[model samples]
Target chain A: MVVSLKDIAARAGVSLSTVSNVVNGYRPVGEETRVRVQSAIDELGYAPNLSARHLRLGRTGIIALAIPELDNPYFAELAGAAIREATSQGYTLVMEDTAGSYEHELSMIDNSRRQIVDGLIFSPVAVSREDVLARPPATPMVLIGEGVYDVPHDHIAIDNIAASHVAVQHLVSLDRYRIAFIGAQAGDHRQSAHLRLRGYREALAGAGLPWDPALAAPTTAFGRADGLMAMRDLLARTQPPDAVFAYNDLVAIGAMRAVAEAGLRIPEDVAVIGIDDIEEGRFSNPTLTTISPDKEHIGRLAVQSLVARIEGKPVEPPYDVQPPFRLVTRESTLGGQRPVRT
Target chain B: MVVSLKDIAARAGVSLSTVSNVVNGYRPVGEETRVRVQSAIDELGYAPNLSARHLRLGRTGIIALAIPELDNPYFAELAGAAIREATSQGYTLVMEDTAGSYEHELSMIDNSRRQIVDGLIFSPVAVSREDVLARPPATPMVLIGEGVYDVPHDHIAIDNIAASHVAVQHLVSLDRYRIAFIGAQAGDHRQSAHLRLRGYREALAGAGLPWDPALAAPTTAFGRADGLMAMRDLLARTQPPDAVFAYNDLVAIGAMRAVAEAGLRIPEDVAVIGIDDIEEGRFSNPTLTTISPDKEHIGRLAVQSLVARIEGKPVEPPYDVQPPFRLVTRESTLGGQRPVRT
Candidate 1:
């Protein structure tokens, strides 16, 4: 049978109130009495019920982070950062993966609102602008990435559009005129892909380059096969592009393979760039030239925002976290090339 | 103002007990009365407090999973599978990332014992056998890969040593000598890596191939860069090996890049193999030859083991779930040249 404070008190020849005070370190007691009470507590092997304590305080000291997929390194790193950030602030983080499924995302949101956690940090997948904007959760919530639907909640993210534009602009600056865009899915209303595509077009227009539909091929999925297929289709064209912009690091790695298979040397023949700057990108053949978003900062900011809101403090505008991005030059684009101008 | 149950009873024109019975569906109420009570509940925006209900029952329908790093695709996929498996069993999975820290692992175990969760699925990192076995938690716990000590709990893991042996044996059967083992770590007692290394040696001995000390090189980390560095160091030798076995898929990917950079053809110039068979392996150049573990099965088994134990059932003894490993032949290993000797 499990022992309680009352049992400890009875065993120690003390009142229940005194035993409670000793356990909580509330009221001062004589040194001898404290030791006796501690000995009794240890002998009984009592375990405090954190859940009951949480219920009494109306605070669970737990937070939930809902991500699309942990298999994706981007989300994985994000989760690690968030966990570290949350733990440092005295909150335990529980990660939930939805695998980018719409129904799963909705169910996770509903579950989070059920108070399993005091607040939620969600990177939703397949949530429409209408659904998110119209039905923001009635609990403390923070939105991560491009699914911001004008909801009045903290939104933490990097500049996908600017990052894309800068990446493409770096390629242009290298005088790679025939640039191809690969690994995008058409009709993806996700703010991330949509904004990045918009930035790609903007970069093209600013450089006085014609937006060639043939150069902007979309892929069915975001895996390496899609990247390879997209690159293969581009290379099969009569006038192959000198450079390719991939959706992410994995896509870029696959496209690089396709380029090598076509007997093309990186930079010397076809330049490539990607986003997310995954660890593998640093060791990819020719390494990868890409835009590196501050993923750690994004995670830290998301946790800070959620924790602050959960504590009932008036947080600065919730959508205030906008992490910076950097363009990492590597062998794919060659070093020290003046950026191409219109 | 929050509406209470008393208000709901008054609005429904019924006794509080009748309203409670109708709300909880305890006793059969008249259809008219049920509808009236339901309407009153909706009007009051009443949502039952599951936490309070759980406290009354002294049971929380939650399980916790503690893993090292989600940044590793294998672990991420494992977490996803575990979540799916637990949800199917009518329990919620709470994920915690320990970042492979021993202190964090201990904390998770302590919390689990403190009733933070009904049961735990823990994949501990940086923990010694004595640390866990010496003081096993009283709660139902399933130890995952990297088993510390014999904690008298269910363990779900693939035979890493045998899996690695199978991978090398496949290479040996191909008559590919001059083999190099990449990504070995010094003084690391992680059962997976150490056992896999042991299997590698056993396979070489069985093949009558002398173990070459120069061929076993340890890397600082298990990332792509570490793989690339190890591969490059091996290739720079006066006589490069004809084949290489990597610790995992990420390391293999790096080795592939290095081999390609050296203008070597896969399978023909240098055969490459790895474990895990990550999804990225399918799209890699020359694809990958790997030992595939049943990640989904391991995940499901972990959940079933914990849930069954929680219900006080005598789980199968040894609970040592050693699943089989399949050697998937890809372009990385010459399909036509695999020589079988008695």
Candidate 2:
């Protein structure tokens, strides 16, 4: 049965307005009366009608975090942080997986789903800046990752190009001349891939090495299988690279596997590095060398920014936030060392 | 600006009812009228208010998949399948990460969040059968995993004891006299852990080996760190086991790392086997041997069952569904073979 304020007041032997005050906290009630009303609510199994209440209040106490890939550990780790933060801030964070599809990403920004959520934290990979710009401004949005930029939204991401420069410079310091870059996309699909590829080229030039289009291998996706196939193709070349840089840790680990399969030793033969310090990279065969972005900062700040906009709190202008990142050197680049077990 | 049916009708130069018919499909409109209304909708960016519509229908086209760990790749893979299935079934699946906390798991079943979601597909780990039984039946819930049982819900899980038998037998068939089991919980919190432990003891008896409590290591949690610490402790014993059977793939991978750190060769010195063939195991240094559960079946079936119940379809009375599992041998158990690239 649908219990109403009258039913609760009747059971608690209080007035209907007193029960309403207790439920909505519009006014403070005496301790004894509050306890009686709470007991009555528990016995009646009263769940406040959130849909009606949200419609009246013009706020749903729920937000959405739209990500490109749910299976990627980097995104998963970042999402975990976001979920915790959203819960602590008194909101439910629902994840919308775009799977890096253009239509799905567009739907996330402009669809009927926007009516149910108070705000959105989006990590767009398939949608371009123009697509994001055309979205209606009814629902507040905070952008994360390097997919779309220069929009009127709170943007949070790491400096992808600088991170790539650090990764390539690490390999150069190890005296590796011929270096290959894996996970270059054909079109302007993944913005980070383009930025990382550009950084790879600039770093090579900075180190007085010629940029070879053959060495910049392209893959359809940034996954382990893609890395394995791309590394195999690179290895088939006449003068294979002695060092490899992959888009992310999953690809780097796959490339490392391909290197081992060809009976080649890491560092001594093909040193490898990647971005995203995922947990798998830590316990990998010859633990991976990677650029560790501050995932906690990116995840938490994105939620905070969106919540600020949702609540209409004083906020700065649409700021392009860049979280810090660092290069981690592991056994993949420096062999003959004991693997770190953390 | 809120674009309503009146606004669309005014823009399309049609009656309000005609625009309503075009939007809701309550009645078929003429082709020309439908095209005119759709173009007006596109121009005005009219999003049908789903919140108000769902409130009237008393159904929210949203389902939730609550899992214990979001960071675990096994759960992530399962969630990916569940999300796809939920999308195919015309429902938005929102993930609730309980993080294996008792309070969070309880909240998922008995809180206001239940009122927002149409149904729940929960993989509970911390809540008990009694806790689940006490939940309100207002919202439909489908339980996955072996944490809770004998509740009035459609339940799905792999045969944990049977899967464990296969894992232990795989180690015994390799002529490994001494075998260890990692990730045994202290109490009845994780039901699968107890079942797997019982299976380990039964398989040992079948092999005519004496049961050794020392070989069965208890962990605080079933994670990579837990397995690493437990395996390290086991290796410090007077006589370490020759093989290890882990709770899942993450623990098994950590145990392998510990063995490698101790200068012990895989399979020759210590063979390791894990359940849940996560992608990480496929690309580990020595590809791991695992009992692969049908995660796709479990993920999809749980969503389908919950969606059916939410839509008030006739369902079989609270089925205890058991999916299939298989043993996959890799270099971790059988040495002297090239690693499978795929």
Candidate 3:
């Protein structure tokens, strides 16, 4: 049987509004009456009709976090934090994998899922800034990651250029020259790639080293295989680089595998660094050196910003947000040491 | 403005029922009429009202895949496959992380999410067969993984005992007499642990090797850290085992880290094997030897089974399913060799 507020009210010998107050906490109810209504609800096995509530309030209490890839541990770790925060804030978080497709990314911003989700936290890889600006302004959206920029949305991301600069600077501090950059995009496919490449160039110039275009390897994707293949091509060059700066931890791991396959010692033959200090980095054979972004901060703040807008809570204007990040040195850059828990 | 079926019918110069049939494919429509209605829909920018449709049909075109951990790449890879299958099947697949909590697992089976999801594909870790049996018969659920058993539902998983036996037999073939088993549960938690332990004992007896209780390490969790700590404990023993069989690839990776930290060479000092041939295993420092379960097969079948039940398709009765698995040898159990793509 569908037990309604009326049924509980009748059982508790109180008005329907009293039961509503107890169930929704819309208003203060007397402790005695709340206890009485609660008992009636429990005895009757009452469950709130979510569909009816959705129709009446125009809120589905569901939010979506749309990301580019699910296999990447960086995104998976970030999504885990967002899910925890959303659950704590009384919302159900659903992950939507866009698979880095233009069509899927466009559909996420185009009200295709508006009816089911109250808001969206998107990490776009394929869509342009103009596409985001041209989208219908029906659903509230909070952009995460350095994909689309300068749109009127609450944006959360780490400073990609600064983080990249730090990673390259770390390699320079070790007195390594001819550093190769892996996972450089060909065009305006991934915005972060452009920013990271600029940082790599700037860091080299700052260290009194000439920019060599041959040292900048372009990868079609940012994965282990991409890193391995790119490193192989770099190693095939007449003068192989002494150090490498990869797009992320996964790519760095792949490069390390390639170096091992070629029977070369790390730090002596080639030092490697990456971004996103994922857990995998901590346990890697020679632990990875990386630029660590505050994922918990980014994930929590993205959901909080979107939820605040969804509920019409007064807040700051839509602006770019850069969470803090830091450089971590490990065995990949330094010599081998005993593993320590992070 | 909300563009309704009436608007499309009016614009296309067709009857409302005809438009409905064209939109829903309830009956065959001529190619010419379908083109006319499609153009009308495109011009009007019509999107189906999912909420209204939900109320009318008492079905939500969304399903959920709930697992214990998102940080674990096994689930992430599986989720990626399920998402692809679900998208191809014309349904939205949302992920729910139970975090291996009893309350969350119980709620997933007890219609708490029935209003939002049409069906569920669950990989339970905490709930028992009795708990599943006692759930209300409302939402269609398909079980994945070897957590619970003997319930009347479409179950898909690898044969844990048989797979475990193969893992240990591989170590036996290498002439390792003292083989240790990591990730043994203490009590009733994690049913697979018991089944795997049984297989381990059976394999040892078949090889005429004495079973040593001290070598069976029990980890609180099945993560890298857990494996690392368990391996440390075993390494401190007066006579450490010559081989280790971990619960999964993650644990095996952690154990490998411990072996490396203790200044021991893989395979020569301690041979290791794990289940779940995740991508990480393929790229680890010394690549992992593992029991390779067909993750794509299990993930795809889980969604297919749940979707078939949700659509009320006529099929065979609910029964247990065991996807194929095989032993894969790599650098961890053998001497190092050039990396090969799988």
Candidate 4:
């Protein structure tokens, strides 16, 4: 009869988990318990399959996924997707919150000294491309999200430029002119805001609409509070735009609130649109019109690519993979007779 | 001069992380690299303070926080809070999604045989109290959320019964007599649903309003989709209640959507209230009116409790904590007049 881990645990007078640990080497085992487990294993003649795999791969069988912050529904949702994908690929995804700090991101890279994680999938909101490239992480990593670094790494993100262009064109299709672009981080190359802003300008130019610099409102942060503040500033102007295209859903939701607070109607006085189809958008007042970049797919691709690189598979340079996006038309941008409660 | 890890890395001609691995004894180093690192350490007259700390405390300096899923905004926001609290305490918070499976939770406990994580903070959604207690994790653990496992370990959660009572009382004070309870898991004693349902009955009894079992709608899950379905089920009743008290914000938001889809005016037709003031609920159309249980405080307390237990501190038995809750009145449950465009 085959000696199972359970049989060894029983013989060693320890838990099944203890026997598994002694074989896996993922965690440090106590000296006395470890010896007892080894003795039981020797007598039982049992060898764990995972132990051989870990030894051959020089791995902890753990993958680290670093995101800026989980407070944002976008990142939180992305993390959930990443976890599912990682689990399916036979690795544990350990989430790390970089807290949107460049220094913190650098420190995480420094953690390679301990060699605890086998691979990394990072989505940085704070670290600059220059800073990231200056001191690269030693482990095989796949970059995901807003900005791409100037390093030979597998990158996964939705084409923010094309997606933004589609979102703006959708607003234009609704006969909305004098459109305002909220959330402009003009000087930041690492911010997706820059690419989205470019897309917005291109869409306006293509439609033969005159660019109004005054209509381009800038927000300090890509969050609801900042979006609200930016919308208020736009409204305070003598000639506010007839439409508002926010950078992301959080900004759009904030702008929606500002319009409601100002006693203005959505899609009538000012149409609203955004990117990133976060789940919150589904329940938002009037709902949100957005460009849906499949986050679950992005999560799956990130893990697959990182695992591929770790297994010494041939991955070519400029390993950027931009997933396709689709326009999601919802009530906010669709102007019609508002549904009234009977 | 005191030697640093950097010096050892330079002496060994290996990466800083590689030197760290050999010194920490947490990971397996290549035989050649291990030999080089040891030689470098002896020559450099180095004594790692971190190494001594790790050995003396039997700590990984990393804490594993296992939650059911981050797709739910409550857990997502709680994760953000926990990360911040863990950072302040000089511990790295490693997030693990238990996939809401009892087997997954047990497997994680089994991982403790390796003794990698110093401690654990678990919020189990699927595991029953008996199962969790019968096969306790080898590591020091603190349980948070939903059900409390009857073990010697610490537990942290909101007083769901009291919180639910207050939420129902608030609806009653609004002169809403036919109040329906959304999200009841009738037979599951391990679920907080039982306690919340009890609270709903007591509140109805105190107000001299008769309790109707038909009004206590059951949900398969504690998320948005289930809430939507449960609300639809309630609406199908011959004489549906005029108000709903949801199990949590996700369910409440889902219920709110069903109400709107049925073309019913909130507060006027069906005022809705829920527990857990998730961030997404703040932006939900008609903004959710709910109980704001301090999730951030709960996250902080769980880490603090686990760390205290790990440090061999004088932590008493039945170390359960229930932080206070506050009511947040919002647009969804206070419908009166429509804000018209100027």
Indicate which candidate wins on DockQ.
Answer: 2
**Distance (Å) between predicted and true CA of A250, model 4?**
1.1
- Enumerate residue pairs that collide in model 2: none
Candidate 4 all-Cα RMSD: 4.9
lDDT of 3 by residue, B1-342 (tens): 989889999999999988776664344467688778878887887766333333234566789998998889999899988988988887778887889989778878877556568899999999989999998787799999888888999999888889989999999999999999999988887888888988999999989999899999999989999999999889989999899999899999999999999989998999999998888888888999999988898889998998898878997889899999999999999867757572
- Candidate 1 lDDT, A1-342, residue by residue in tens: 889778999989998988766654333466678678777877777655333334334466788898875767888778878889987887778887777878767665553234346788999867776666655345588999876556778787787778888988998898888888886557765557777778888998888889998998787656666787788889999999999988888778778878877878788889999998877666555677889998899899888888888887876765646799899888778833221110
Which pairs, if any, clash in model 1? Answer: A154-A318, A173-A339, A173-A340, B129-B148
Clashing pairs in 4: A27-B114, A113-B17, A285-B285
How well does model 1 score by local distance difference test? 0.76
Model 2 TM-score, 2 decimals = 0.88
Specify the poorest-scoring 10-residue window by lDDT in model 3 chain B: B49-58
Worst 10 residues of 1 chain A by lDDT: A333-342
TM-score of each: 0.80, 0.88, 0.88, 0.88
Q: Could you tally the backbone clashes for each prediction?
A: 4, 0, 0, 3
User: Compared with the true structure, what per-residue lDDT tens digits does model 1 show for residues B34-78?
Assistant: 778778877777754333233223345678888886666777777
The per-residue C-alpha lDDT of model 1 at residue B116 equals: 41
Flag regions of model 3 displaced more than 4 Å: A1-56, B1-58
Give lDDT: candidate 1, residue A149: 52
Query: What lDDT does candidate 2 reach at residue B184?
Result: 87
The fnat of each candidate, in order, is: 0.42, 0.57, 0.54, 0.45
